[model samples]
Target: MNSPVASNESLVSVENVEKVFRRGSEEIHVLRNLDLQVAQGEFLALMGPSGSGKSTLLNLIGGLDRPSRGTLRVAGEDLHDLPDRKMAEWRARHVGFVFQLYNLMPVLNAERNVELPLLLTHLNRAERRQHVAAALDVVALSHRAKHYPRTLSGGEQQRVGIARAIVTDPTLLLCDEPTGDLDRKSGDEILNLLQALNREHGKTIIMVTHDPHASARASRTVYLNKGQLSTEPVI
Candidate 1:
């Protein structure tokens, strides 16, 4: 699926971003002077050992958390300045999130689960249904629209989660360990789906993963080490 987004441009920019957690008199810097830039429609992966701050970096980019210092911009908006209310709006309009846990309501059917994000918007019911239907179709899960989470396999549930992430047609997709809980076959399927979403839909994707194979699928891979990105390459 080719992205509907226009020309190649800087969709996300991080400049000297730093995150420091102060506990008592001690300070823990999760990210130190980090710098990253993502072009529109590009797919990038962040990888590192546990506690390397890959997840912290992803959270900062997604507006789930903020940096202690530095300029972080996404979709032309400086994230450091987006207040809580405005950040919520920015996230709803410009960014989509996918998690390893396949965060879905157990009671909701696939379609309804995909519709959850739309509830945050002003889109009417008819428009919302169209968006949900299209997103599911894109993921080839329209057939499972009525199925509950328990009825679907792990892969299917994850696909539903992906659908829900893309239903809002956001420009940026931020994923945290998307395949951490899946079997090889299911993880491969999910990876292929994400590639399609990036290439065909032109969604700029930033994914964090421990799997080398998974990271290899991305156009570029960055390593987070000791609170900063490493210039060294492991491959």
Candidate 2:
């Protein structure tokens, strides 16, 4: 596949990327010369069949993994060239992840959970608290700051997860099936919050989802199939 022409405004650029996993004597190709571009502050939804590499693509963009062969750049930095330590620092400063399971610490309260990411930064305790408070407020969970994951509803717990993701005010938000575990009403609410973050907070977001309804909320949607990208939906 030909690589997409990256514009100056593009925040993520993946060109001729390939990812292969080795299983002893065999090699499994997950992505094959895949190309994609995401503009700054753009909300993009990636949809595909199971094992179609949607999450793999998301992980690469988030700097959680690297492609076996290709070039990748995010926010003007060459992700493909960064060392492990540099990559970790860059990821901590620029990328935020929202998981399907919330992934909160079982013993931590909402406030403490949201403050976890800030501990890696140079900020003081007071600064971390202010950031945590603001993030909880954004999710409208300020009143539940002391609530633990087990005590909160599924929707509220997801809100806390979102607060934790945005606590650093990251340059990019990578969500993997963020609403997959919620009911319809709760899912819609989460979608609305994501839209608000994109439109108001100017956060660049890339979401992987199987639900067409969830994908509809994004600014644009793309399909992945057989390790390739297409604008048309995959059937």
Candidate 3:
């Protein structure tokens, strides 16, 4: 694959990327010469088979993992060039992650759980509370802000996770099977919420999903197979 060129509005540029795994004397190739360019504030859905490296691609973009070869630039920073410590900090400031499971602490209330990201910054307690309150409001969970994770429904808990992701106002939101664990109705709510965030907050969302219904909600849907990317715009 040719290296994906960065356009004027590009937020992410993936150039000739490849990811390989070595096991004993054998090597497994997950991504092979893949190319992609994500525009700023674009909502992209990544779909593929279970082993097609969708999560690996998201991880690369989030600075959670590195590709074996090639360049990945997010918001003008070379993701592969950052040191581990700097990468962690960069993710906190620029990237937010939502996973299939709402990985909230068992003892923390929704407000505190949403405040976790803000704690890494210099924000005082009142500032943190303001951010959390606004985030929860965006997801229509303001009424449940004081409830513990265990006390909320699955959809509510996931909404809390979404609030936590956006509290810091990250430019990029990366979700890995965020609705995989929810029922159809609950999943639809989550999808609609994500769309609203993208439309209103201008978040650069890259979501990985296997479910067709979930992917259909994205502005653009791309398929990955055998380590290559195929784009199909969704009307």
Candidate with best lDDT:
2
Q: Which prediction has more favorable lDDT, 1 or 3?
A: 3
Superposition-based RMSD of candidate 2 using all C-alpha atoms, in angstroms: 3.9
Query: What order do you get sorting by lDDT, best first?
Result: 2, 3, 1
lDDT of 1 by residue, 1-235 (tens): 3233346657788999999989999999999999998888889999998998998899899999999999998888888978899999988887788999998899999999999999998999999999999999988998999999999998899899999999988888998899998999999999999999888777789999999999989999988888888756544
TM-score of each: 0.94, 0.95, 0.94
Task: Please provide, for model 2 over 143-228, each residue's C-alpha lDDT reduced to its tens digit, 9 standing for 90 to 100.
Answer: 99999999998889889999998999888899999999999999999999999999999888999999999999999999999789
lDDT-superior candidate, 1 or 2: 2
Model 3 clash count equals: 0
Q: Candidate 3 on 1-235: residue-level lDDT in tens?
A: 1112344568888999999989999999999999998998789999998888999999999999999999998877898879999999989988889989989988999999999999999999999999999999998999999999999999999999999999998878999999999999999999999999988777889999989999999989999987888874222
Task: Assess each prediction's global lDDT (C-alpha) against the native.
Answer: 0.89, 0.91, 0.90
Candidate 2 wrongly placed segments (more than 4 Å)? 1-7
Q: List the residue pairs that clash in candidate 2.
A: none
